[model samples]
Target: MPQFDSDPVFCSLLQGSSDSRGSFSIDMMDYSHSEQSYIRNSPVLVTVLHDKYGNSAQITDFAPRFKQYGRVFCPVMTIRQIKPLNGSPRICVRLRPIYEYGAAIPQITHGSNHVRYVGPDMILRLTTNYSINAILDEIPVVLDEGVTLILGPDETVPDSVTEVGQQFLNQTLDYWHDWTRSLAIPYEWQQEVIRAAITLKLNAFEDTGAIIAAMTTSIPESPDSGRNWDYRYCWLRDGYFVVSTLNRLGTTQTMEKYIRYLINISANSENNFLWPVYRINGMRNMEEQIVESLAGYRSMGPVRVGNQAAEQIQNDVYGDAILATAHVFFDERLEKPGDEVLFRILENLGEKAIEVYDKPDAGPWEFRATKRVHTYSSVMCWAACDRLARIAHHLGLDNRYEYWNSQAKDMHKLIYERSWNEKLNSFVGSFDGNELDASLLLLNELDFLEKNDPKFASTVDAIGEHLKEGNFLFRYIAKDDFGEPEYAFTICTFWYIDALTSLGRKQEARELFEELLSCANHLGLMSEHINPEDREMWGNYPQTYSMVGIINSAIRLSTSWSDAL
Candidate 1:
């Protein structure tokens, strides 16, 4: 039996195959698309097999059966010998490309000492290693005679394509391994963080280096509702967290590339007054369009592409961008003085923060219908001003230090008083509403209050009691108009981890942190939410913000634990 250090779920799914010689364990997981049938119709079949000989087999029968073990069914596919090899048997499996319209058959091929295949609509070539051939050759010999078998409605490809699919799966595993090995996370949760971190990076669009909010989009926030939205674009508010996390992990290359992307987008935008919340390839004209022609995930209506929030006023973004840039400057350990362009950018942001810090804007959530003075937004505004002041002081730039400092102080003071709901004994979501926000947990890290401060401690307890669900935490209580979302924000859990560490509850913090880490999928990847009931990953895959949380929490836990020891 071959051992796999990656994606055990996939490994187990592929291990189900039986041969005349008994059963052999292949490395792969089979993920059903039925749960999310709207976005994709076909299930995903992944496996790792050894193919020493060029000879391989094709998929002959494919079926899915739902059992008591799990909500989703097991995928069964038959394989037939296509050719015989003198050396080792080849490994392979088949997959149907599930899209909105229907399924599409994909062609499989081999090249460059590996297997290569292309689905008609695939954006990139799928490749795999030679080891998978052995798995392909061991399929039940009865199924190897090219017999047709029952397949699901969503299934389009025949069993003959199994070899190609196996090839791609093997290649994918190799690609993931190579990518994971390249990352250098020195934190104590290095192994765990590295796995999650690599997944986040893989989800990034290679050409633009823009990390998508998640991997698969349109996973309904509600059941069979029109709540699905594409999360495949970049969000400025998340950029700082992503970059800072990568920096802490010593993976600066991708973050640097992302910084360049940010610079280009910010520099070239025609309407700086309205910074888009997301854009594809830095294009600001991101119009929200529904693919009415195709079904949504789980038959959820109106699968949307492009985010309308792109045009909304998210003032926190300005602060997040500045904070990320500052972190890059600080973490890179730059010895030289700050560049003129970078300094100018900071100065402009400081000026903007000073001007808009008092104004009510659509807060971080970008609530479409309401515009209020959200406390989290105010905090970030304060952060932007505070960071600028520190940068100016550090570089000895004789800019408006007094003005920036005064502005930051005023913002802080406002949040302390106006943003607090004294009656509830917790910080409110906004000045207009009494809802508590999990984002307030960021106060300690932002230095708004010491971790042990009575107010901060109370706030933490308040969030734990009001906003937490088991080990997971929601972003905030649902507003009257906005329905409650299904997924727990992964980053918020990490924030809680950081908060715990800051409060000197290192053991508790480490335990909670480990629990959160365990929420990741078999590949060490996380989505926006982990279904509390089933604990399966929901929302997008490979979320950068979630990975950022993993990295930062690990850093805090390791550093603090080491110091205590």
Candidate 2:
């Protein structure tokens, strides 16, 4: 429940030049090893610093995570190791951590070799093998040998800093190596796929099986566009994409856990009406409010804490939940396969989908004011009944299969009658509406239309003509509650790429995918939006939808290892 953002530790070298005031000038060091790589392909970060003199030092940082007693143990502790490689390096540690959203300053207390920061809700202890006085007073110290720092809850570590740090590092490295070995990664772009896979895993909340949409809040879609929204909670639509993409990579544990989360949400629903989003703890209420205390990202103001879209009716989530759950029923690798009781719970959701398939709702874009019968929402509604029929047939329930199959066929016929725009030679965004949206590109992927269908091909070409900006595809060009959107929603481009490949445009899809990969940051991570004019990343960081797009595209486009051999 406590939310805040601040760097925990700051260090400065003490050998910089001095000004006339007798203070050392703050000279920015030229960084050489800028790649965000881990230690031996593990989660730990290692960095080396060398002075113009012969002195060099190494800094390794990691959060301890390993297996214990046949179960994973990942504590909320971070360990840092600093060792002298040559000569002696001088540095100062500025240990500062603000609490209560930068409002409360923690009171510091220290013993012989540790410092404690007591705040309102929690206390953090910093145990170090270096000089306690030097750390507490922020004084300069010489690094002549290796030292370790451990920061965690206010409790004794029960081991020496160096010993515990080394043990945890070794265990964590082994954990990651074991995990990567189990993955069926693509032959090409193996490193990028691995990094993206790790990022998707990091976004998942292990305790609840709820994966957040992104880490930060209020990052604008474009400069001064007032398009910011908090993304620190779970959305069922986004969760489906994450789990399904991971399933394609032969990583099923994440999907298995996420299926439990979806079942919990669906089974507990009152009147079988499911919300589009929820808190990470499976709570229903997420009231949107602006925090007046802090300036927004880049001073955009109106820093929102919760999302208002949770209150809106999105019919597509019914299908999203069922699609996510269907995997558990089909995948034989899971320890707990979907049972009859679980199918009954999902059947209620399918019934709800039948009631809302042709009705108006917010749609996937979550427009604040407008409500329309979106073609994509109807497609998903059809998918819910379609998938249920398949699940029923797979379970040997002939009566239920026939029932759901009939419902799906009726919905499909109605969607085609109302959504197909003959004048434009494509299906529009809404029923009987004339606007093209990027989501309509999913017609083929959702099985609403086949790849060889002329309407599907025309719809793909139509969306590209209207919404595509160079390689990036805008969600739509039409005006919304926040006026016209100014930046490209990153995942829409991936959907477009998939559609192209399905249409036998492999070379073009490959080129666009490679160009889109170049748009990721140096660490191979993407946000929610990208500015087309300047190619700058915008919106929340490490977005789940964007990262899922990377994995799916790579899997579809990468050459097989057998082909290379």
| lDDT top scorer | 2
- Residue-by-residue lDDT tens digits, candidate 2, 114-152: 999887887888898989898777677778788898888
Question: Please, what are the lDDT tens digits per residue for candidate 1 over residues 401-475?
Answer: 666787788888877888777878877778756888888888888777877788887788888888888888888
The C-alpha TM-scores of every prediction are: 0.71, 0.92
- CA RMSD of all predictions: 11.3, 4.5
| Candidates' C-alpha lDDT | 0.59, 0.82
Cα shift from native, residue 278, model 2 (Å): 1.3
Global Cα lDDT for candidate 2: 0.82
lDDT of 2 at 50: 66
